[model samples]
Target: MTDATAIDTTGYLALVRRKRLYGTLLLAVFAALMASGFYVADDRNAGGFFDGLHRIFDFPAEIFSEAFQNWRNLPGLFLKFIPSLIETLNIAAVSTLFGALLAMAMALLSTRGLALWPRLTPLFRRMMDVMRAVPEIVIALVLIFLLGGGPVPAMIAIAFHTTGALGKLFSEVAENADTKPVEGLASVGGNWVQRMWFGVLPQVAPNWSSYALLRFEINIRASAILGFVGSGGIGYDLKTALQWGQGKYDQVVAIFALLFLTIMIVDHFSDRARARLVKGGRRA
Candidate 1:
């Protein structure tokens, strides 16, 4: 027994040493690859990375200098852009609402043990993977070309990406749900809709709401950028301000302030709501 125990201990130490050696080698290889890639990219650049590094703050300095000199213009610009700001928020809100609703349906349809058609689960999962894989900006650009640029196209773009993102998250949450309730409902002759509505939804609603809130915050930023590509929101206004160069820097600052304030407000409320939802915590 003593001999066998000694052999086992020796083998365990050898295995640990082998794993550590492999891990170190892997880390070294990864670092080398990253260093090589950086050098390759820098060589390919028209202006080298280190060469342009010092000038990076030039544009920010110009913008701030002009914006500060024209500080009094900020208030008017803020009031002027409020309507466009609302439009941007509208795009985000509509997209999040539609996307979350579709995500809930797709999540239920794709989740194993809860799917209405288990055989089609792979198909739905692949569909979501594709959806999530494509960037929202790519979709927005395509739709803008086809639809001639508006909030509608931006809304569709954000919603499309949101569906895939939220569907994946919602499905993950639904997968861990209590199977007992689902089983009990099905045993009572409940249809697929009934079983999911009564069993799965209740179990996952808090988590789902938290995810949706987070997505809504992200969509606001996306929609703002989409507007820059001619989607008719505050982003479009910002683009116009940028095109005007020196004279419009104050407008640019105004738009930035609005976007910053809006994101901060949304993030604050969403954090509180998620805390309350996921933990039933206090308002703070």
Candidate 2:
């Protein structure tokens, strides 16, 4: 075998010489400028910044104190908050459920390779882009203005946003699905929808279900924020508590903690369900 350690100092130095110090310096300067711009745009005072920074060290204590200050009054708080919380969940559930159904249709449209009229592809893509571009809160605010405030507006807002996001994800999944079963279905003279139903759906159904469940959890959080614009939910309670300054910061904090717990629990269950589904599918 030939020895291979023949590299020289000149070549090594030449390699090192190619390192672009000016490019790196330019990048550092660009980053610093961007950060400075962000800081200026934020308009936070130095004193307020320092105070907020100091509070981070005591955040856990602050959160705990805020949650537990009115432990005795929690039952009454719960009595008042439960109805709104239920309404929030209902809004999230109905929104995600109905939105997922609409997303299923849109998803079919998104996978242009599966569609005959390719012209519809751009239109569907643009539709999804538009829907997803508008945030749920903006949608809720607009719907509230148009339809008047109630759960309906909130539901519609959540549903539209959910459909947009879920459609995009579902289409990507569908597009990447195994084509073998689809080919078999086509060979057997099955139609497009039939091929999708039996072949594509079976392959991606588990992932789709998991995505929909995950979206439900997200919609719950969105539903909470919808109340800021009078859409009604836990957010309304939070807004009221803040506005009234009735020393109900503790109540608001407790409710928020509860919302956090609910999300965590839902995530755990959804993960378990997805795992079970994946395992069952593999076995089948």
Candidate 3:
């Protein structure tokens, strides 16, 4: 009945009082502690409590200089580089294919009602959780030790890790799929396998291929690194070149540029393929 627009002075004052003024002081203290910690951890600093500003633009001039020197030595460089590149490609291709198969199996298991063991959703999810918790590099390190440092260990590592990762992602995609076709298949007395084959696979195949191609690009990089552990690839050569020093640095840069360009080309082609797939899907 009074002024409806009037503020509730008591409530407003109580709310203002409840605001924690100490929050800003606490935040400042936390920020100061973090800054001090970062300063202490910085390598560029002298024996002071804080490190000096880091030289962020320290480029390796030696690498460029060596690369220029080796520009005329292309034939000799190719002899050392081509085998490693092929090995890397082989690792990537085999691992990606294996991972795709494993991902498909795991994805089928993850769909809520699609699997035979519908009650084992928690178990399946937990298993996937465990698999995905471990990083691919860590897995590769372990496998290298267990299986003896070779391409086999690297390929297995890539396969298992990719399976876990792609499986989880593919499972989520499968879950989000439109249920109408699945339900239709069920109404026609279709079994789980039939529904999966005729309904889910058709819809998700393009997305699955897109993801696989992306993974392949990542695999190429991983394969290169696997050589660090004696898994055999361009990374091994790169490591050798680094250790050799001076003359090899240029060659290393050249080889690295080639590897990077290869990945870029793969990415470009994959993007085009994905676009074409999407367009074709839409037209259909």
Candidate 4:
């Protein structure tokens, strides 16, 4: 028995050492890959990191100097851009709303056991993957050409991406849901819609809402970028101001300030809302 125990202990120690060696090797490989990638990226970049690092604050300094000198114009500039800011916010809000609605439906349809048509689940899942794979810029640019540049194009582009993204998240959450409620509802002759509505929705609502809110924050940034591409938002104004150069720096600063403030406010509210939702979900 003593000899057997000694053999087992030796084998266990050997296994542990092997695992540790493998883990260390993996970590070393990952570090080497990261270092190589960064070196390649730096070489390919327009401005090398070391060269740009020293001047990193130059642009910000110039902009702030001008903005500070023209502090009196800040309020007027803010007022001037309020409408565009509103348009940007509207684009994000509408896209998020539509996306969340579409996501909810697609998620339900694609989820296993919860799907109304189990065979078609793969089709729906593939559709979402395609949607998510396409970048908003590509869609927005295409829509801009077809639709002639407006908030609508940006809205649709963001919504399209959001739908796929939120759908995947929603489906994953729904997959882990307790199916007892769904079975209970179905046992009473509930239809597909009824089963999902009474069974899946309640369980997934909080998580779904949290994901949607996070998507909204991302969509806001996307909408702003789309605006730069001519989708008509604060980004368009910023682009125009940037083109004018020197004297227009103040306007650029104003737009930057507004965009920054808007992002901060939205981020704060969404963070709190998500926290509340998650907490409420756990309690339920």
lDDT of 4 by residue, 158-186 (tens): 99999999999999999999999999999
**Model 4 residue 38 lDDT?**
95
Compared to the true structure, candidate 2 yields what TM-score?
0.82
Task: State the lDDT of candidate 2 residue by residue for 1-284, as single tens digits.
Answer: 12333456666666767666667888999999998986885576555554587777574666457657767777777777888888899999999999999988888877867754567988887898888888888888888899988888999999999989999999998888888998899999999889889988888888899889889988988998898679888888878877855466677766776678778888888878877776675454
Separate clash counts for every candidate: 0, 0, 2, 0
TM per prediction: 0.92, 0.82, 0.80, 0.92
Give residue 53's error in model 1 in angstroms. Answer: 1.8
Give the alpha-carbon lDDT of every model: 0.94, 0.82, 0.80, 0.95
**Over the stretch 114-207, how does candidate 1's per-residue lDDT look in tens digits?**
9999999999999999999888889889988998877999999999999999999999999999999989999999999999999999889999
Q: Which candidate is the best by TM-score?
A: 4
Score candidate 3 by lDDT. 0.80
* lDDT score, candidate 4: 0.95
Candidate 2 local Cα displacement, residue 11, angstroms = 6.6
Candidate 4 deviant stretches above 4 angstroms: 281-284
Q: Which stretches in model 2 have alpha-carbon errors above 4 Å?
A: 1-23, 42-47, 55-69, 278-284
lDDT of 1: 0.94
What is every candidate's alpha-carbon RMSD to the true fold? 2.2, 3.6, 4.0, 2.1
The weakest ten consecutive residues by lDDT in model 3 span: 50-59
Lowest lDDT block of 10, candidate 1: 275-284
